[model samples]
Target: MHKEGKVVPLAAATDRGARTPLPCLPVLLLQVRDKAALQLRQGLQALFDNADDTLFEMADKAADRFDQHLYFEAMRDLRLKRKSIERGFLDIFYDTFARIGQVDPLGFMAANEPSRNKAQMERAASVEGMVARVLSRDGLALDQLSLRLQTLLECTLAPQHNPLGPAALSGYFLQAGRNLGVGLRVKLILLKLFERYVLRDIDVLYGEANQLLAAAGVLAELPPAPRRRAEDRRNDSRRISATLEPDDIGADSVGQAFFASIQGLLAPARGRIAPRLHAVATAQPIGTADLLRLLSHLQHYVPAAQEEDDFDLGQQLEQLLLRVSVRSGTRRRIATADEDMINLVGLLFDHIHADDNLPHSLRTLIVRLHIPLLKVALLDKGLFSRASHPARRLLNEIGAAAIGWETGSEGLRDSLHLRVERIIQRLLNDFTEDASLFAELLEDFLAFSQDERRRNELLEQRTRDAEEGRVRALQARQQVQQALNQRLRGRVLPQVVVQMLVQSWSQVLLLAWLKQGEGSPAWRNALATMDTLLASILPQRDPQALLQHVPGLLKALREGLASVALDSTATRDFFQQLELLHLRACAGAEGPAEVAEVLVAEDIVLAIAEESACAPLRQPDEHAAQLRAVQRLRIGAWVEVLDDDEPLRCKLVARVDSSDRLVFANRTGLKVREWTAQGLAQALRLGEVRLLDDGLLFERALESVLDGLRQQQVH
Candidate 1:
């Protein structure tokens, strides 16, 4: 029992001398158990009936274990079955437990003892305290008190090694009934007292503890509390500021104080600004009423500043306006439509009302522009009131354009705002003298918009034309190269000479072939001259002399083509190609003195044999071809060298130059090596090197060296 606001341990109550066994103790125990079982059965049947499969399963499982008196097993099965049912079923289950608790309080307390011994003891003390408080006026009998204390101890202090079995309360009642020497009537009255007080106390304590846990968000057994209204949520969100300490301000204290002061100053105009500010804060679109209210409040600022000189009202008002202006500038950058324009103004007022992030100095400068802006709106409400209004559009455009204005640069920020102010001033000045200025402004804006569209259209057309011309020129080059390759087939010539002819003269061929029979008389005559020059370079002619004529022949071809009126850009491109090819051919010819390696300027040869014919438009599998070519290169194999900026020339690999460089001999038999092994490997990978088998040629050379070595040995 609990006394003097403290829980007196059950051990203290049990210290009293033991009582003799009570007569008919067995009958009393049977009566309490029967009553409890009857109440539990009636409650479960009424609640479930034929409805719940989980309840039916529990009944079946418990009935099978009835021979063993496994009431604890029945309760465990009930817990398991309850998990599979709807959440609403828990209410009926707890109610049934409550009804059973009324029939046998001690037994009910034991059965529901918390799984943890510590928690069960704490709960027993709490229930004991409640019972003591309720029955303080009517003291309990010693025997009754002793019985209740024993029951509480049995339920709470029971060793929890296997709590899943029958309640320890049963053992306590059995031992007490055997020990106590009281009659059946006295024992039955004590049992009634246990049911009335201790059981009722347990229910009250359980309910209170559950409520506390649920309120603290620790218990999920109960339903959640109702949600707060929207207004309440907003208030709760803002409540943190009330508890903010001075130390919390830190470096941003000035900004915070300035905002607070602005809000205080604007309290007088709250009637006009509050509704508009709320709409903006909630992200709602602004309407005409909001705009009109904003303009009225802005008008009050100027007069208030003029009258309150001592208060520095003008400077404060200026600071407020500057803050609004800066925010408006930010909003303008993202505004896409008319609603955005209206929203911009609403947001500006909201910032001013809240004094959000505004610096003191900027706020002053901003105040100066307010009167001019307001006057323009008064002159033509469309200026600030409507999104599509020309004035509104102009301001938005200026704001967007000024987004990138750097404040660190000298006068840049000032210049941007000045330009905005000048526009406002112009509108105010013109509206006072001539209302027609609005019409002129609208007309000028439309004209500027029209001009921008035209410029964009022109740019797009030019881009398209250039792309088409590029594609056409590529097609023409491909067609001419294919035709020339076809025409040169089956001719025997040096490979270098053949390559030179194709690279240097492909452009001339393209022009002549494209203009043939399609141009004027002059172009036709030029084409004839080009064909004649091309025909003179046959494989039967001296290859060296024909190669020498290449430069002079190319110059004549260009002059003749120029005589025909061709597209200037096309003609320029053709000559550029010719120049590049000429430079490369000249470099190759001048580098080596071997006439066998050079071909005459007029000589045109088809070096590709029948077994290894070159397909003009057919691209080879470069990677596979290069790998095969690399495999064919023996110690003294002859090969034609290919480079990005140099013309083709024959070479012999002298030896491996270095780890990363390759050595080769020029056509004159001179060492002219400067190739990197990695670069050579890449060229080989791209199939740039062409293998020329000269095994027999090298065999004879080797034989001569062997004979010379034998003679030296004889000497």
Candidate 2:
């Protein structure tokens, strides 16, 4: 009964004088399938977790309200249905494996399946297309995965029949999502996410499954598949594969369009500006290499970060070109291409220097990289033609990080500011003929910023949740106070009744409103009970009506009081006092000082609502536009505030509607400032605060320069 690679053994049994052997092979296969399912379950959990964050980020970054709401709703739907979807996938997987050995060939034919309608057919085609795309992308890994599965089962299985195949996995996911209230684009985005987070490492899944089956004496050994790559990584110029991410498909096209617009401006400006430059007509033009060397030489002398008058790349280049032409006796001129690069770089940096989106300190640090960037641009034209070019991305990353920076906070000591300064200095000190430095720095900076962003986002979410909770509590308290005041103010009542109404009844009212809202039956009942208690305490001519209401009213009061868990002794005393008041009302009498006193006295307790703690509903009419601007600001919008202290940089993390308050957090997601709509509007009107444009810096600069050239051409 021994077998090679067998880890478990079964006892041989006999029944009714005949030998009945167990199906050991099927049992072993089931064990292997279960082990593989466990691995897949873990992977699916991670996929859903990452998907949650991705959807939230998309919602935050969405350009329009419609898209934002769509993503947010999808996120909520996914959260509610995630467990069932995962269960459905595993159920299908387990059932598929269970039927592998038992399924009849004829029974599994197409004739046995139900016919699909037109919409179903279209949806099926779309799902199949998605599966086909995924299979095509990871064809090598999938082929080997299928081979391993077939070897273990000693059977040929089509993709749909293979429990762990891409088709099966996608089919179940699509079926589950069919009922999800999301648009086609969102569905496609989720499919892409599945490819990235789950299927991206599918080879590992099959590898572990194969290993487990082999250990259980199922195909103990097999030939290893040859290694292959999904995409080519070579020195030759080629567009980056769009398969890398969902948004990368159009990145290169956008970059090409930018270059086209830039070249349009450069061509006309070059011809008109050539005669103005005295060096252009001096002598033979120097090669781009010689121009780079001259720029690199001047780069070393660039001023430090704290220098008031920064190093002007254009001024220094002009000086260096003049000296070189004079010393050579035969005047040297910059080549057409080199001259255009210098001019374009100059215009780009000039725009950068004046960009109000970036803080003055960051602008200074970024300007220092002008020479190095110009040199890189001269060496590789991809700087303008490729969005993913290292130099261009590094510049973009720096600008993106500086979007929330402020003028007066930490001149050079800020972590981001320091990191940018270090990178710029490294380029100036190390960069020459080699342009790979940009790529190296880009990788390091991306890792650093990613970790920083994750921490900040966590803190920012907590801040938002806390502010929202505070707002909810304030609103509930205010609602309870209003209800109590409308019923009790200016009315004569006993001190005991007032105390119970304000102290005990107010809690009960607040709890009801907070739990079920103002429109719920519970909130309405709570209000009715307060009114009944007040009526029972005052004089009532209709003794019969008052007598009939006393029992139900007392029951409702006791239940309300019990819901809030007041002290037993206190509850007993309150009920006793209420009973006496009802008795006196039925007898057409009033308690001591019940008619002469009013709840308007300062000594009376009030509901939890405090006017000072809440923001005002409106601001002065003169600041109407400012208020509208504040209202228009999104959650992630960055703003710079100029106060009596240093200028503070922060992003709007939450808007508390109950208080009309805007909560702002710094880059580290620490609550740095907050203001009501009125307060913020006043600040904006007084020129003490402004919004920052957080768009990509390079793109903005290029567009600005192009627009300027277009205007000049028209003139």
Give the alpha carbon lDDT tens digit for every residue of 1-715 in model 2.
2133422233212111113332334445555565566556655775686566557656755789999999899989889988887877676565555555443222222342577555455545655665676566555556655665666556786656666776666665665565777776677667666665566556556666666655655545555443334332211112212432446322344334445556756765453323424435556677888888898898898888777765665566667766887788766666666666678888999999898788887897898888898887777665665555678889998998888865444656778887888899999899997877787898679768766876798799888877876777788877887787777777667778888888999899888987889899999999999888887877788888988998999899889999999999999997877777777776664444343334554333443443334223445546778888988999899988876477778999999876778988988898877888788888788787887888878878988887898897787
CA deviation > 4 Å runs, candidate 1: 1-344, 347-388, 392-438, 445-465, 484-504, 510-715
lDDT of 1 by residue, 363-452 (tens): 333333344344344344333222333444454444332322223335424644455444444554443423345435544543453344
lDDT of each: 0.37, 0.70
Tell me the lDDT of candidate 1.
0.37
Candidate number achieving the greatest TM-score relative to the actual structure: 2
TM-score of each: 0.24, 0.63
Local error of candidate 2 at residue 664 (angstroms): 3.2
Q: Mind sharing the TM-score for model 1?
A: 0.24
